[model samples]
Target chain A: MSAPGAVVAAPEGLHDREFGPANAGKVGMWIYLVTDAMTFGGLLIAYASLRRMGNWPDPAEELGITISSVATFILICSSVSMVMAIRGAEMANRKALLGWLGATIAGGVIFLGIQYYEYNHLVHHGLGFTTMEHGNNLFGSTFYAITGFHGLHVLSGVIYLTVIWIKSLNGRYDGDASHVEIVGLFWHFVDLIWILVFTFIYLL
Target chain B: MSEQSHSTKPYLLVWIALAVLTGIEIWAAIAFDGTAKWATLVALAVAKAGAVGWWFMHLKSEYGWLKFVAILPIIAAAYAALLMAEVVAR
Candidate 1:
């Protein structure tokens, strides 16, 4: 099997680290994301069990779903932008690449902003990692843990994308987009995980 | 790389599908209750995840061990669910 981070070395005729016919580096990212999914899944499974075990608060009534849904839409849009960035990278369209990547980063930062507001709203209402006024008052801890972890991923993605955007401006991704596409994988994974988290934590 | 590999049409379609599913998810959460609501919401979430994974993430084009590696989590989740169910049953 090929080594992690080094998907089959540079082809004989090609220069170093250039993607081969398969762009297997993207696949490597996918594999990494799969493992990341399991980590989130385990945390979620524990959360589900906790909700079942406790007299948890009504998700709809206690937590703000409308804003979260809006945040969800923003992240979804970021995913779209991420794909556009990948396409731009693959086609070597620097303008489109940088533009779409900037849009994605903006979307992520906005998401974080909305989340910060949501967390503040909840905390002001007396719900947080250590305290809760609603049913299953202990639910606050798990709620924060799950969402906070996902929030950190968004923060990281934003930083990662900002770097990519800057480098794109510098012509780093002109000939090859293996790096941008990989970052897109991570960004899309964050979006995908939010889908599951939104359903399980907020909607369901 | 194939020229066809760099298209945006499929990504747009997936994005639209995801948006529509999310709309349905919010509506289902409001419209239904009990097990039906949970089922509908979960089903929609799964569909959205699949679209993102299959299209945006390009798992559809990946194959072999790469594919298996990408799919490993679902298998593990299923196993964990069964184990948890058994323990709960006891």
Candidate 2:
């Protein structure tokens, strides 16, 4: 019995507790995503500004749309897998969780691979940041900058989800999925951003 | 926590819709020109993004406060719009 006015201390192992709301971790992730949105938004807006102001190169002349389109489809499929993973987590179905997470990670990597192939192709065809077949220099710079930044995000997302995948196999997040859900938020955001990027940089 | 476990149906449906939208975007990009084309492309892109966010991300079921965080991107869009206008004006 703790005395009156005494600071009641919790037992050694039971002292730790969740310090915030049940969804605090998700809220934190959302906050981080908000900041990320601004960063990407700024870059995209800058790309738009340059396109509107400068003599932009005909993307059709240099970039490959078919490949990027396929990549975009892969990412969309990956997001579906991510959703499945979350649903699996909610049900404590380890097999579904691991399978879907693995699929999502594979999707990210394949997207990056296609991006690498595209970048190499563009560079081989004389479209460097400072050197483009078109007289305008800004076109290459903006395209590379916007798409490259997004690619980096995809790379990190792959690594992030891969960690989550391995942990799921080990049943680390059993009976809970806040962490998986948060990663799914990030994965879907990347896919969303890519949709915009594909339209702006490739299609427009 | 979700009270009921989700099925694969919704994910599958969203997947088919997104794939179809991407095909349309490609067609619009190649076929149209000028502002009309740009408008269509942007609209399709927004639709695709919305589908991914609302369904795949499960933002629809998320807490309201989290949805409110979307304001950050709106601000970004405002900034982009304003800045692009400035660039064009100059």
| Strongest candidate by TM-score | 1
Which ten contiguous residues of candidate 2 chain A have the minimum total lDDT?
A13-22
**Interface-residue RMSD per candidate?**
3.7, 3.7
Instruction: Give the per-residue lDDT digits (tens) of candidate 1, residues A27-88.
Output: 56766788788889889888877776857878888896999999999999999999888888
Tens digits of per-residue lDDT, candidate 2, B4-90, equal: 333678788889999999999999888999989989998899888888877777666654456767556876787777877788778
Instruction: List candidate 1 stretches off by more than 4 Å.
Output: A1-28, B1-6, B87-90
C-alpha lDDT score of every prediction, in listed order: 0.84, 0.81
The DockQ of each candidate is 0.55, 0.57
Q: Which stretches of candidate 2 lie over 4 Å from their true place?
A: A1-22, B1-6
The fnat score for candidate 1 comes to 0.67
Candidate 1 vs. truth: CA RMSD?
4.2
Docking class of 2: medium
Query: What is candidate 1's CAPRI-style docking category based on DockQ?
Result: medium
